[model samples]
Target: MSADKLYILDTNVLLHDPNCLYEFKEQDVAIPMTVLEELDSIKDRKQSVAQEARHVIRAIDNILSAATSPTQITKGVQILVPGTGDDSKLGKLSVFPDHELTSRQGFLPIEKNNDNRIINCALHLQSSDPHRDIILVTKDINMRLKAMGAGLQKVEDYRKDQLVSDVELLPSGHYHIEGNFWEKVSDVKSYQEGPNTYHKVSPDLLPEAYVNQYVFDDSNDFAARVESIDHEKTVLRDLGFGHLMQQSCWGISPINIYQAFAMQSVLDEDIDLCVLNGAAGSGKTLVALACALEMVIEEGRYNKIIVTRSTPPVAEDIGFLPGTEEEKMTPWLSSIHDNLEAMHENDDRPQSSVKYAIEKANIQFKSLNFIRGRSIQDAVVLIDEAQNLTPQQLKTILTRCGKGSKMICLGNLAQIDSNYLTPLTSGLTYIVERFKGFDGAANIHFEGIFRSRLAEYAEEHL
Candidate 1:
């Protein structure tokens, strides 16, 4: 098929996402010979990567090997399908002075992936034919920036799936609720009408977050349902949770420290909402469920605990995903099961009783689409993988909170699944940004991955 765009594949781009080959579609794209060479080196390995590395190299090799002549071989920056080639000659690769491509960032002695050859190739291509556009496709943000800074045209994230920059994304949150005050709000006059919980603000933080749809009683400090101001009981720094308030199920689980504790929040009378945001394996969902179970079995706070993830397979992407939504979500939601297993492990209840609790625990594995019409009052709603929810979608889910209900949105911002900034503009930010001023409202940011040293290291380095 013929196409308009010209794409030059970088080594990292292919390795980062193996499907990189088809992403260019009908566009004129060519994997750099050097990139192919790089893939060859990884063909024989024990790791999972060896299979992919070998597959990509073998596929390309077959396509190139059968060509009868150079004229029929893959040429031009424009992509040719596996067996197709363009007769139009683009001439041998143009050569440019080495200085045109080198970066001072290179002089710093970083290892190979951040090397110079990739950058040089793009500069040479661009400088040689000013009219012929050469796009350097890479996953490295720094490399792209360095390429641009060096005067060559460059682009980061060549995953053809990327949406427009203006596309709505999940909004990253800000920590604005950093003060100490306690009080209650009575009339709640339109204050706590929804089943969703609302944050009651301390006298100190009056009228901070009433942007729109936010009901605020600015004149009063000691209202109902909101916390009552306390003067006698001090900060209680001795509780040992100095980095956060209240204990977390995973990180910095100090019962006392009240600095930057993170948890999902919902309604108090109906079902208390405690949100947890931590890196993968940080026990955010596990902890949220533990709390939910506590309320269901012990506190009698709510009828059931419902857990959901804001993700389902998109159409084109689901081809590789086996089975139905249940099967697909099974792998992704393994974390949910793992946590539930942990919750029920060693319990005295019978298998049926435990299964009943788990089933009756009111845990509903749901997609973001169904949350619109349901008024979830008197229920603990835990939304996992919330980063996948866009801002508008998240707003819709949050607004569906019914009377005496709690909703918890949890996700790691850095590990977003959606093509858009589904980690930022989503409802998580909507709630965090909208509810900081209320005294009854509390939030925490759990630091340090509790899974393992390697998991934490992976998050930091990779």
Candidate 2:
């Protein structure tokens, strides 16, 4: 398979998440001796990955030990590096605020600072394996730059977070129609022509998306509709929920998949920007993704699926974060992956080889701090962590959208992670308020949390 799939491990990759090695199940995996040395140095450090790496290394060693003298270990990713080949020997080096490499830094009292030695290890490997895909993988960007400058192929940090937006992991965007969709309810109760039906809307009917447009069609459907769009900002008209199969992230939870079908019924350009707001675990991401999958690979409403999140990091976070951006983003990006796994589990049908059965191009996991001034088009953009965004930030993200693109911002306004900010002042709130009158926008909120009884109770009561 010319997948060009030779991989090298970096120290920070293991530290970020120990299970990262599992993501490449059957691929040829490599770990520079420097990375191993780095891991050895940190094995006793009090961090989650350090603990995990100890176990991981033990497990891998066991596998290596079990391998027969005759049988080829034809499968599974292995952590390996060159030893007899490189002319270099491990050197001890110490790094301090004032430690400059130009000063002939040595691994003196310190055996080897985690960064430089592993880098030297990577460089040595590159020197030995010149062309057979010798790549340096590290979470440290500067280290990556150093490796590249040293003439080694340094790649971006590939966290098991699987941050890449694959065809299957992409998210969908939606629009809401709340403000004028039902404002002056007239007895004019015809799908077409007002007040001319003469049959009169029964007291039982309320406004809703009937035949793909909002009208006082009936009331029984609004709760489900509101509930569906509330979390996913999509309509559920197909599952016999009420309306037709309107699109966007309406409902895809175990309780709401029916609503998702209905929302798919209403999927159309008329309602482009869909809002799926929910308390954590309500399956907002799942449903948004379902709709996005539908439009992208199934219905062709989009060319690609782009999922972006803006953590906004609150001008003042509680304290300093350890490690780097990858470390910082792990906690937040997990929400997206959690939703994706749920979607994949729910999706039992056969899928395409390249694209996720219903989705494609999850795209890049962008930090809200970046993405400014970059224009996005021809895709369904999902802005997660929207609660952290201010009205201005939200506006900026939305303006980055180009022709034929739709965006959905999903966040818990009440969960407002940003400092000194409230639900009413969140960027999501601003977007809802600003786009209230736009026919292309839809604002929906999901109140029920589908994660766990304890979590829901905690969110509700304590």
User: What overall lDDT goes with each candidate model?
Assistant: 0.51, 0.52
Q: Please give, for residues 1-462, the per-residue lDDT of candidate 2 as tens digits.
A: 312344666665654445555455434455544565666877775432345458556644644553453232323323332233221321111111212222143322224455555555544445555655545566566767766665566565654443223312212222243444334335433232332112223233333322222322233343222222222123332223233333344234335533353244235565667767767777677777667766776677788766667654421231355555445555657766665565556455423322354235544455554556778888888888787664545666788989888887777756776543455445566565555535677665554677899889988886
lDDT by residue (259-325, candidate 1, tens digit) is 1233323323422344455578666776677666766766677787666675535322333578864
Q: After superposition, how far is residue 424 of candidate 2 from its true place, in Å?
A: 2.2
Off by over 4 Å in 2: 1-266, 312-331, 346-359
Candidate 2 CA-lDDT value = 0.52
Clashes of each: 54, 47
My TM-score estimates for the predictions, one after another, are 0.45, 0.46
lDDT for 341 in candidate 2 is 62
The best candidate by TM-score is 2
Worst 10 residues of 1 by lDDT: 232-241
